[model samples]
Target: MDAFYASVEQRDNPDLRGKPIAVGGLGGRGVIAAASYEARKFGVRSAMPSRVALRKCPTLLFVKPTFEKYKAVSNEINAIFHRYTSIVEPLSLDEAFLDVTYSKYEMQSATLIAQEIKNDIRNELSLIASAGVSYNKFLAKIASDQDKPDGLFVIPPEEGPTFIKQLPIEDFFGVGKVTAEKMKANNIFVGEDLLAYSKIELQQMFGKTGSFLYGIARGIDHRKVKATRIRKSVGAEQTFSENINDEISINEKFTQVFEKWWERYENHKLKGRTVTLKIRNFEFETITRSITETEYITNKSDVRQKLTDLMRESIVAGVPIRLIGVSISGFEIEETDTEVQQLTFW
Candidate 1:
């Protein structure tokens, strides 16, 4: 799915096709949820401020997000994935990893399976999808982004190590801005640079994440693709167009966020013990307070009281707030029987 939200908008509306477009709120505090490739050419990107994106692409069209429609399309895409393999791990609404070592269609080559999946999506849904086929998740994930729109790339086992050696440190999956700066400071600017340090040395420099960096630098990813992934937390946040300092206004805003969170919690049928309250002030300072109960919080009043207490403790009086969020975690895991199959080598 290329520029998923924007693509969907374009597919549904002819006027938006081939035009720079963004999907999100078109307000002062709004962020771009997704940007079309046309908009990307002008340096617009998702998570960019709406105003900033507008400046980057003055002709950028803003459309309000239709999440319900996106979710429905995501379900359709997942259904297509199921036709090939049951071992599908969804990263988000737009992307997933499929382990096709023993696919339902009895495909021996993962590349062929990827092409078939891409074709299925395009032919059936009238949308473009890119795919990466590799022996492991890390290389596969990296390869997936190498092409644009309707494209497929394959990284064979023999090419993985050499390919990784020349790759930039910033391009690694887990290397974020802060981590990349630390790596650059240590002269670890590329995968080949990482090879100069031993695992112990890397660990000393990067803490726990160093071990992961060491493995990926050598194209040694041993992670399995799990079909079922347990969600750790469910949360929602709202950014305000105007800052509110008064208690009445703050309470009203908090209630709105709380209601949205409650709706999601009920929809997921989640039972969790911890409730967290998050607040961001006008100065951009953020704070969070949480409460954990001995048992699962089963009622709205109980969660609301916990959030109210957290808000009372965390918020500064007369300080304008710009955002509010609520979340619940520490969910009880229900045991379910799932059959694990041995990988079949071709």
Candidate 2:
């Protein structure tokens, strides 16, 4: 799935084919969630301000995102994957990693399986998908995005190093803008440049990240394909358009945020102990005051009251708060059978 939201629109509507489309809100505060290939040519990109995107391409066709429809298609595509293998790990609604090492079809090679999956997506969903065939998860994920929509890329173990050395550092997974900037300052601009530094030197320069980068540079990733990835943290943070200081105003804001979080936790049936209040003053200094509840949060009103109390105790009326966040920690949401069986035994 490429340009997922916009692609779904194009797939369902024949008239939208090959047309520039922007999905999400089209107003001033709106941001692009997905941009079709045609939209990309016009400088429209995901997470970019709608105002800027429109200025770049005056004729950019704006389409509101229909996540439900996109999710339905995603489910269909995932069903297609399960036909071949059950070890499928979805990164998002549109992207996934499939472990076809032991597949249902008894295929001789992973590349063939990838090709067949791509073809099936196009024929059944009337859309395009790119497939990556590699020996491991890291290489497979990288290879998947190497080619564009309707493409297949395979990285054989024999040519792994040459392939990795030539790959742009920016294209390497987990090497974001921050890492790239540091690498640039150190004159390690690409995979080949990264390969020049010793593992010890890299570790000294980048701490834990150094070793990870070195392994990727050498195409020596040993990470297995993780099928059941769990959440590490679930929190919401927001920066307001302007600072607010009135006690009434801050309480209102905190209440709204707490309500949203409570709903999210309820929908997912998530459990957590820590309740953190993150605040930023008008001068731009940020601070967090968190408390771990003795018992799990089971009510929305309880969280709202606790968060408001922390906000009041932490900041004064004179201090204008620019941002506020309510965060929860120690989420052990998975209701495992072992735990359930223990209860039964008791």
Candidate 3:
């Protein structure tokens, strides 16, 4: 998928097609969720600062996101995937990884499967997609972006090395700007340069990420494509409207967050025990705190109490907090019947 949300918006609304559009915030401190291909020409990109995106593409259309509509479209596309294979792992509302190794469609070629899927998306939904075909997940992911806005790219196993060799270090997966700059400083700019180093040498220099980099350089990825991914955890975190580090201010913010969670999800009858707390310092050192409760809890207040206690103990007064989050996991729901509810009330 490419510019998934923006593409969906453009598909439903004729006016936005071929125009630069952004799907998320257009205000201060907002980050780009998706950028249209037209917007990308002006240097607008997803996860970029919204202010900077405007600076890049001043006339870009800003559409308040319609997640429900997008979700509906997502389900339709997912049905097409299911027709081919049951092993589909959705990465987001837009993107998914499907293993067609044993598909029902009898499609032997990954490239062809990609082509048919792209066609279905365009003809039925009036949207475009970019596809990558490769033997493994990492390589497949890298392949998917080779073309954009209704394009298909393939990376055959034999040609994988040569393709990766010329790619910039910055363009490689998991190499962020800071890491790219570090690699540049070390005079490692391309896959070939990355491949030149022994695994031991790379490990000593880059530490934990060294082995990962080495594997990508040689196209030696061994990661599995898991379709039945369990919901190990469910959590939400926010970078504040304005970043706040003061413990008291963050606690207040936590209360605010808790209040919202309580109002909305509490009534839905969700159950989870192991509550986890996450905090990010001003500099982005993340810390997590977790507590298990005895109850089959659903109310947000109980979750909030666990949250506040965790925050109170962990937060230091002077530090500026950049982000905070709460998560629940490790349980199953006991569905309530109407009779049970009436009995409890009585």
- Specify the highest-TM-score model's number: 1
Model 3 has an lDDT value of: 0.76
Error of 3 at 37 (Å): 1.8
Model 2 C-alpha lDDT per residue in residues 58-105, reported as the tens digit of each score:
888888888899989999999999999999888788888888888999
Best by lDDT: 1
Q: Report each candidate's C-alpha RMSD, comma-separated, in the order given.
A: 5.4, 6.5, 8.4
Q: Which runs in model 1 stand beyond 4 Å of their true positions?
A: 200-207, 262-276, 281-319, 334-346
lDDT tens digits, residue span 44-135, model 1: 99988888898888899999999999999999999999999999998888998899999999988999999999999988988899998898
Q: How many backbone clashes does candidate 1 have?
A: 0
- When sorted by TM-score, best at the front, the candidate numbers are 1, 2, 3
Q: Using TM-score as the measure, name the better of candidate 1 and candidate 2.
A: 1
Name the candidate, 1 or 3, with the larger lDDT value: 1
Residue 86 in model 2: lDDT: 93
In candidate 1, list every pair of residues with a backbone clash: none
Candidate 1 displacement at residue 248 in angstroms: 2.9
* lDDT measured at residue 122 in model 3 versus the true structure, 0 to 100: 79
lDDT of each: 0.87, 0.79, 0.76
Model 1 accuracy (lDDT, Cα): 0.87
